[model samples]
Target: MSSDNWTEQDVPDQRGRVAIVTGANTGLGFETARTLAARGAKVVLAVRDAGKGKQAAARIAGDVTVQTLDLTSLDSVRSAAAELREAHPRIDLLINNAGVMYTPKRTTADGFELQFGTNHLGHFALTGLLLDRLLPVPGSRVVTVSSTGHRIRAAIHFDDLQWERAYSRTGAYGQSKLANLMFTYALQRRLARHSTTVATAAHPGVSNTELIRNTPAPLRLPVTWLAPLLTQKPEMGALPTLRAATDPAANGGDYYGPGGMGELRGTPKRVASSPASHDEAVQERLWTVSEELTGVTFPVE
Candidate 1:
């Protein structure tokens, strides 16, 4: 992400580091996992589908394990974390990269809006539960993959955080993405006050991934044909997150993404969050709501 020349070979040897990539079976997640594993990190693929997860792990050219993790369900999230902790006590990287985008309103098994629940709350819970392990590991990091969509709806409606009253898929996605950035910012602050874990965020910039298959055909065409022009490949998209994780100089709370037109697609560059995302009050409120909703506590706990 630092430059287009950055490659997996540039990463230092990480033979002892243990890393986890949520939704690591495809797209940017897959590339992140593959590169991490290739770099000698003990990589775990936290995926929702077992079959696909195994397939993904198999495709990676390094040591990797695939575990079932459905972020939308607290039960699934807890079970996966418990299963992971039973075997691996040290974690070096936690990539909150699995996400759903612009889904037509659908309720999760827990009866929450799908996009927000899966994209943010699931990760919120997973990271909280794993803090015990992450905090103990030396030089550990947490990478939250956010988006430029955050510039759209940075508002946190305390009373209606789930988009129940007014539902716009795009609006909800934007809100969730902003929540990701806000969470990343607040998390880094909290970690600074408590643990050594660094929390950073990344954006894939219109990468061609299965993440967009659910969209309408018309909407998919332009992206499919023009993504090479406007979007970086999934491998390119993963670099920003990878750089944040492995780069010696990358800092906590620094958001990385493509450096191309309007920040759409190119090599990774350190970028600023919208002024709205800089609101400490809103971040604190969102953190409180997330904890209450996910039943996971952070530094205070």
Candidate 2:
């Protein structure tokens, strides 16, 4: 358990490390990448838009590069992994930070729910494909960003994974975020044998980011009015993830989030997740389903 004041200044030196952060074009991902790069890590801004990615890299003051990665497309994920593996044979950190929030009922290019496909499945395949590179590097970490939304009407909904019967944007978004936590737990258990690599999870407590673009109109005004009091800046929100990615004391399967009330808007610290997120059965089942859906298998047992 970290203290209630674990700010970015507490992050240890990251010189000689290599980090890949998805969706690094803006928001929390950009802050995470920028902070790590500032500390001397070679950071890759893996995003879907090359122009935006290059623009983001230009804003950072360290060795930052851009790579194309569209999580909605498995083909793109594979290509990105191959490119990353060739460029960085040993990855010290892989931050699964890309995600879509509450959007209208939609499916990915591969016909899966957009949120689940991109947030969970895409990252699942990418991690499996790139696991080999991290395995040889001691202390390597794969930090997946989940969300507080996971506790809001979240369930695996195995039978209706695609929400074909009915779709509530909130429900689908929660499911995807919950999947992120489950994936972290399951991956950590599998990677336990290697002792070289670890899996962790983090959440930014209600940060002011572009992720809320799809919020219902009714709640938009109230949210905007309360933003100053309810939301933290993106840089502050990135603390938990940065800590999870670089904290030497952070253990596999550990979850980091804001230390403030309701795990929102404060410094980073170890935090507890919803009870539903701790179900081993659901985690295992989701893992199997993800493997089948993505056609990607882990190197671990």
Candidate 3:
């Protein structure tokens, strides 16, 4: 989309919808939840910290619910999912919004690398586990928040996905974000082939968010100074995601991001990806590997 295209007011009617926004306590996630709720959707703030999430929702000025969801733990994922299923019964939208970046090497409670485990695997399992309920409610959508880092950090080291052999915080972060996009595209293709639920991805162009709190001082110094000049506010970056989740014109497999300065910061825009990302083989492999790792197959058929 052009920079001068549709504005936030262009967001479509979202009444009667129920959205589950992971990490809805702050950053882009919080803005997403707030927008959805204000638009009349019952937004559920799924976060790791219930207290913080409650406070965030309380400030949203809309219908918002607080729910605990720690993406680093499969057991936590399962429990939170079960709670949502039991309580809401159906979820019309799922915003895979939580993520970690440039952190010290660590593993999730499930033993997988922290970045991939939480950003990709957790959402993989959560979406698959909740598939039944989501499918029952027609026109449901799953929006995975991704990033431009995929361009800098291509290639999935299947041999050592945990990065025990080699680890660079930036590289690991990029790989994880790429996996989010790959999963989004692959899942959308799978759904088109055999199902109806739509899958889409978006990136908040260098938005100032807490995802970078743990970033190295060297990296943070430049980012801290450059963000205000180059990055859009979290609310602005959240617009593309909101569009993906609510707009009926949003097609499955389409990607949205900033259109200005190499997609770094601008109004919401639909963009393309590298050829490697578009490779069908890689996406299928990633999908199969994800299913095996999570032990939760998304039966799109």
Candidate 4:
């Protein structure tokens, strides 16, 4: 299948596979889970709100279950991982899809910036905790969802990662998204030896999702006005992630995004990230700091 024409219809059979998708209550996450479940995967909606998770599950067909997961809290992440480990034994796909966009200055339960803590650290810990199960399962994949925002004024603020000195909502979001890509690259290198598991990434490309609620007013107005014309629907936005998770041709370290101009919206295809995201030194440093912050380590070397 050509990259420019990939769509959900191209996703292969996933019978007997188990996929855990975070923040599956609404928007792109929900759509991703729905599509996977429809294709015969046992889907677990790991969400912060059990009620919402159940509601989301009810709307989907096939084997669908909900698990409580609060990424802002490390305790919640640990508990969710334990529950998942006991239930599935082996996860075929772990989609790190939950995220927070531009938000007012805030900290996670661990005092880290909300965007970095929840979007990157939370998934970091969850993946590390569950990686053992994935290692032995051939073709198992860890798909982390990043964003084009990583290319827009984004850098890993090694010194003030918590944004203790100053804060810019968009910048923080970019850092978190960039961290997602860095995590994928670093993890793929570690998983190379195992060869059974792989790590990949995807970006929704300017989708109309609930994630936009926190956009700054100045930018929010124009985005709201042009959203219908410029943004893709949540289902379309989820195509990149779904393809990354299930595409037979996708490889470890490959990234999927919209193939349209500016990557705003189109069919899912292999895409390139910003040059900064490919920096090996920064990727390694972020991985080490993430280990220290999350206190979770994978079994892989």
Candidate 5:
């Protein structure tokens, strides 16, 4: 396998594997689900809208199902997990690929900042709730998709986690993405003893996806102009995630993303995250806070 130019063809056979991908209705998640299903995995599109999810599943020619999941609400997350657990006694993959980017300031049903709640906390809780299903399965993995946006104005912001004092869409997004990596590392540590299930993270870099719908007005024109040069298609964007989820060599705590200039776009490869994302102290603190906020605890702990 060419590590530097790894592509979807590099994915190994996934026969009989049960894979769940959040927000699988379109873009990166859709591409990820499509490739995994093509490789013979039983793909479940866990999306917010059941109708859209079914539509997407129908378009993919493989064994696929739809599970309604709205990450903004803890109730919905738990409900979806329960349903999934009942249907799948064992899960081979859980991809936390659903997320909101640079949205206007708002709170989720549980009252956390929209981006943080939906992007990091929602996946954190879901992973904890369904971790038991992956624990016993050999070679099972939990792959969370993060982004390069994690570096811009990113921090734990322990003092104002929800941005009650002030708000910047970019800052909130950064915090959420950074938390994704932190959660991956922290979860990997807890799963270290099990040796069967691993936790990893990946970023799509800059992809031309619906996620950019909320781009601030000022940057819209420039972003549109640079899109062709800086952004990759969703198919290419999903590669880093595919590699992290199924690559034979992908291990716990590994982070994968584009190998091109500034990791904006190109082939998927092993990549490094920001220094701040590696802070174990912050990671543990965030974990504790997440447990407190979501009231969900990991069985691995």
Candidate 6:
């Protein structure tokens, strides 16, 4: 397979590997979990709904289990992490593939902006809690799924991180996605010393998935009109993430996405993010703030 055109078929064997895929019940997360399990990985569907997770597991053909995880609640996050720690002594892949997009203004159980809480903070705490399991394992990776939206109306918003005053759905979603990339960079930097587990990020481009159910009416019109040109199916969308998780050439802090025009759709390949996503100071600041918010500290460094 060409490095520039990697596909699911190119995913190496996953036998004996234990992978935890958040939101594995549907969309990109589901596709990602299914592919990994099919490749002989012992996959855990870390979903919000245990019933839906079991339903999804029933459809896959390999070692698959379900774990309930609600990203909006810190209590649930901690509970799920504890359960996962007990079940899996080591984790080969931790895919933070769950997220919300363009959601209405709302707060999480912890009173943080919904998108930011679920998309970044939840995953941050989970990774920190589980870092020890991956540290000793060679080739272990933490793959967080970011988005092209990270570049649109995205900022750290340190002044009012929770969107207390006002909120733009798109802006909040963008900030969350940008934070995902920054988290990966910051974590990878810390993991560099360990030299075993690495953190990577990926985007699905614009794939046709249920994640778009919350698109505001105005944006929905354009997306619907250009759906043919802008969107690919969920299977294609899962490729970038799969590549980022499994590619032997992949390095810490590398990002993967569609290799096509405007990065809207195409084969999976190494991709670049906005300059804002690469700001080291911002990455460190976000990491610090995330730790403060989640109350979970990484064992790294």
In terms of lDDT, the best-performing candidate is 5
lDDT string for model 2 (1-301, tens) is 3466787777788899999999999999999999999899999999999999999999999999999999999999999999999999899999999999998889999999999999999999999999999998999999999999999999999999999999989999999999999999999999998656999999999999999888878888898999899999999999999999998899999999998888888998899999999999999999999999999999996
Q: What is candidate 4's lDDT per residue for 1-301, written digit by digit as tens?
A: 6667987888889999999999999999999999999999999999999999999999999899999999999999999999999999989999999999999999999998999999999999999999998998988999999999999889999999999999999999999999999999999999998767999999999999999999998998999999998899999999999999999888999999999999999999999999999999999999999999999998996
lDDT of candidates 1 onward, in order: 0.85, 0.94, 0.85, 0.95, 0.96, 0.94
Return the TM-score for candidate 3, rounded to 2 decimals. 0.96
RMSD of each: 1.7, 1.1, 1.6, 0.7, 0.6, 0.8
Q: Which 10 consecutive residues of model 2 have the lowest summed lDDT? A: 1-10
Better of 2 and 3 by TM-score: 2
- Looking at model 1, residue 165 earns an lDDT score of 92
**Candidate 6 lDDT over residue span 1-301, tens digit each:** 6897788899999999999999999999999999999899999999999999999999999999999999999999999999999999999999999999999999999999999999999999999988899999999999999999999999999999999889899999999999999999999999998668999999999999999889999888898889888899999999999999999999999999999999899999888999999999988989889999999999996
Better of 5 and 6 by lDDT: 5
Q: Estimate each model's TM-score.
A: 0.95, 0.98, 0.96, 0.99, 0.99, 0.99
Question: What is the clash count for each candidate, in the order shown?
Answer: 0, 0, 1, 0, 0, 0
lDDT of 1: 0.85
- Candidate 5 stretches greater than 4 Å from native: none
Error of 4 at 38 (Å): 0.6
Q: Which rank order by TM-score, best down to worst? A: 5, 4, 6, 2, 3, 1
Question: Residue 249 in model 4: shift from native, Å?
Answer: 0.4
Model 1 TM:
0.95
* Model 5 agreement with the true structure over 192-222: per-residue lDDT tens digits: 9765799999999999999999999999999
lDDT of candidate 6? 0.94
C-alpha lDDT of residue 288 in model 4: 92
